[model samples]
Target: MMTFSPQLEQKFAKMLTAYPEGKKRSAVVPMLIYAQDEVGSITPELIDEVARRCEVTPLQVDEVVGYYSMLHRKPMGKFHVQVCTNISCLLVGGMELYEHACKKLGISHKQVTADGQISLEEVECMGACSWAPAVEINYDFHHHVTPEKLDQLIDGLRKAQ
Candidate 1:
């Protein structure tokens, strides 16, 4: 069985406490997210551990994982790049930006680089319409990105690794 670090255990406890009585199940999603943030991907052990803590069935935790887009069953790259191509972004050259990133990274959507340093995904929306043509590397959002800027961003991330 995989053990969660003390810090993660404390976070889980804090999250569980934030909910009212009999609502522990509500913490499932966030708990899984936090767990993934630490361990990468939703492992069987994590599903079981979360299920035990939330007092829900392992199957229930699995269901929750499958429902959320942010949750992943497999490990992603160290830097996961998500480009928004929704209408708001599309109107501002988001699709072109995505193409530029794909070409630059030499990887298609949902594909990781051969070195496992980066992964790319074309998302529908990132809720950054006003900043249109937004890109997210991991949790940080970059607004109004151009092809040259994307190159710089990717190059920077590569160098950081």
Candidate 2:
């Protein structure tokens, strides 16, 4: 049987009421976000609960979650670092930058560091060709990045925490 904690139930109830009855599907995205936020990653159980509460099929929730890169199906570090490796960035040494990040963080793409502080991901153009070799940490973009600059940024983030 699907079960949700009182808090989750309340939140889901509120989410349901936020939309009209027939448009409960509109809550899919927000529900996924809430589940991810609550559990740090979306699980099958959470998806099932979301589907049950939102009155949608599990496949519908799965489709939406899978379509978005921001929704992590598995565990990820507190900070997610996505490096752009598209055509423009590749021309300007994006590959080298990605390598440098892996070496510095001591983890491969789609892997989280041992310290659990950061996870690395490779993505297509971040729509910043003018500033090729850019990386997004969480949501902020660091553009026109060099190895040295990236090192500094990483250090700054570590220091900030």
Candidate 3:
């Protein structure tokens, strides 16, 4: 069985109304976003719930969740750190910066720290090649990062919180 808050049900209902009859599948993406926002990550149960509410199949919800990188399939830290390791970033010292972050945080790529404050992931082309060796913390991008600056950046986030 799946549980949903009244708010989520209402939001899902509104989203379903936006599509024509029998086209409720169109709301999968937004429903995934809403689910992720509520639960911090998308789970099989959540997908099933969304499917039920939207009158679609669970596989349909799964497809939308799998297609979007922004949709986290597993639990992530409060701050998701995505480092660019594409051609442009690699040409510049992205690898070194990534290594430094791993060393400092004591976690490898695609892993979250034990404290659950941060999760590190390597992504392709953050589209800031000109500012190579970049990382995105949540929604903010930090460019031209060096080993020393990485420490400062992490510390700054901690202090801000």
Candidate 2 residue-wise lDDT, 11-69, digit = tens: 87888889976888888888888678667788998888778777899999998888887
| Model 1 CA deviation exceeding 4 Å by range | none
Candidate 3 accuracy as TM-score: 0.81
lDDT of each: 0.91, 0.85, 0.84
| Candidate 1 per-residue lDDT over residues 1-161, each given as its tens digit | 46688998888878999999999999999899988988888999999998989999999999888888888898888999999999999999999999998999999988899998899999978799999889999999999899999999999998899
Off by over 4 Å in 3: 1-21
Among all windows of 10 consecutive residues in model 2, the one with the lowest summed lDDT is 1-10
Taking all chains together, each candidate's TM-score versus the true structure is 0.95, 0.79, 0.81
* Candidate maximizing TM-score: 1
| Number of colliding residue pairs in each model | 0, 0, 0
lDDT (10s digit) by residue, model 3, range 49-158? 88887788888788788788888888888888888888999999998888888888888887988878898988889789998889999779998988888899888867
Reference-based lDDT, residue 107, model 2? 90
Which of candidates 2 and 3 is the stronger one according to TM-score?
3
What order do you get sorting by TM-score, best first?
A: 1, 3, 2
